[model samples]
Target: MIEKYEDLNESYVTAGAGKDSTSIFYWGGYGTDQTGITNYDKVDGSDIRGYLKPESGSYNGTPNLSANITAWTNGALSDWNGKANSNVLKGVTTGDGPYTSYATIGHVLNTFLASADAKGYDDWYIPSCAQLALIFMNLTSVNNALSAIGGQQLSPSKAYWVSSEFDSNNGHRVYFKDGSVNGSSKGSRYSVRFIRDI
Candidate 1:
């Protein structure tokens, strides 16, 4: 019995896994236009981000971390979230992705996305670096929906956080401006785009 949530601006398909199975959707937040905005939507506290994971294997068949890092920074990386997550895929489900509960916005993002009643689904999880890259590729469609709903647009050249953690202190941040995935401190402020399983 998955909970169903809808609102004047509920963006379900965008948040859920894509029909391509290789892509993921970007759920829009309450923005200036109010597209897909839901009352259940909540952003994390200011300056409250944290690490996503300590270590990850590789993206798809490319075990070379350097190559994978180079891919996203150039353009959006498109790999099936399920098919390509050979290295970063973890079993952490709703209420279980974070090392702790409600300690930071990063944890909250994982927990909420897992249990969130978006389009009557509740199997969301934090996306690995590769998965995030797919979302980056689909940002145009995503941003359009957000703009229609008066939501914020993801800046083209800004660093957006991915769930890939390089170490205890750092997680991956994808540069939407370029497509480069770089490791940064978890506490550093950046935009979050949480992708769930289809």
Candidate 2:
């Protein structure tokens, strides 16, 4: 059984364990950026209210990829706005499938968490790549809370999908084993842990 604790914060709830949950999902199809939305950076009181420009460039092994990842992971919380990124994907209808058709990860997440009986909240979303890194940085604390609540512990061997997209074909993900962020084909299957504002 999963139990909710107010003190546990967003990190705990986003660690892939909660009321009713699964371990893996696709990152979903591509979409345009969703601007002018209010989103949060950290579980703290910090708020970022604007649209973030979509990240550009090639996938892993690029000359500047490391720097880009570093900036994303260590930069402002606003750049890691998974909610807005997920919202963008949610509106997509040109490729893969539409969000309303339940053909993508965003749709699946909405169906799972938007219900009135779903963990007493309905705003859960796929974390951005940087957001996933933040969760990894606090893995110890997150795992502790999961243990307390009888939730599934995030595994180090697993790769988790994030809402950040690299292009129409690839999306970002984080490897828990080394906390490395990289881009992969959206069609690739990986673990997904939802996050929301507290």
Candidate 3:
């Protein structure tokens, strides 16, 4: 059965709660009020900082190696607001449309949206280059939690797409294998994963 966001409990909500069936991988806590406070330790839900990565199956589907970023707006090059980028690429429509037959940003965005909908949430979006770097920084802990839950761990051998665009013809991607960040042709296909704010 599909797991709903509400089904997650405190264990999953708190930052660095631990690895268990009920615990979700917490990246870190950031103060939502822009208080410039970032707590790497466990924090309660009241804190404005926290990011939750769903199970691998929930976001990472078959690698759409053919997916390109140039098929849609390149204006989503923000280093932080991936949701906005996704929204712009998806247009104002409620479902998939206007995407080319070949895998593209629109296709990937729609795929993520469908997964989010299945989880009874609608805020999931592609991670920006900065967000992807954050994930890389905490790869060990994230992988541990994923392993504990029988979820697929991030592969070091592959590069993953980010929402940041290098230009109209190129976009940024993170190489997990070596933690290298670079911009490549928008036509290049790479792995994708979605993240949501807590």
Candidate 4:
């Protein structure tokens, strides 16, 4: 069921999903740049639970992050954005896709996030591995909230991509398997899921 930002709230709580693992909120936050590389770096009050929308195309993760990639994360919490920006700075250029050939995840995901609109907000960005983990941590609740609108992945059968890079030739992903994270080739085709700041 398609929803508005006004709809997210505490009622979707699942176990182990809070700052203390015992509560829920309309939004939640984790991770920041200043905190270095910690998984759950909270930046004061970036309590934004991104507005996620599952898209229906597969993209390749190539062209590498060596091109002039652009990072869209600033004044936001996740370093994924900064890293993505840095990666884009390294990208050669941005263009259209069957991105399945040689375009990095940053090129595809960041471009999508930058233009996405959920409810009324537009400050969207990709989730870091840690931020993606948060979604996995609360999958049940996340699914519940999304279920109302015939949303995707109420029972996901595959992994979703993450914006974090493992190196110049690889990227990361997570899904419904015990939050098990792994790396894939940048040129490999994978599923796409976009999330926005709330």
- How should the candidates be ordered by TM-score, best one leading? 2, 3, 4, 1
Give the winner by lDDT: 2
Model 2 RMSD, rounded to 1 decimal: 10.3
Task: For candidate 1, write residues 33-142 as lDDT tens digits.
Answer: 12121111101111112111112322322122333333333212222332232123222221122322112323333334444334444454445555665556566776
Candidate 4: segments with Cα more than 4 A from true spot: 1-104, 110-120
* lDDT (Cα, tens digit) per residue for candidate 4, span 88-167: 42242221232223333334433333432333344444466556655655667787777665565534555655555444
Candidate 4 yields a Cα-based lDDT of: 0.38
- Clash pairs of candidate 3? 30-49
Model 3 regions lying over 4 Å from their true place? 1-78, 92-101, 115-117
Q: Judge candidate 2 at residue 191 and give its lDDT.
A: 65
Show model 2 residue runs off by greater than 4 Å.
1-23, 30-78, 92-103
lDDT of each: 0.38, 0.52, 0.45, 0.38
TM-score of each: 0.43, 0.61, 0.54, 0.47
Q: After best superposition, candidate 4 residue 60: deviation in angstroms?
A: 27
Residue 56 accuracy (lDDT) in model 2: 31
Candidate 2 per-residue C-alpha lDDT over 37-133 given as tens digits, one digit per residue, 9 for 90 to 100: 2322321123221112212322322122233344443323325777877777565422353322223456555555654334777666778766676
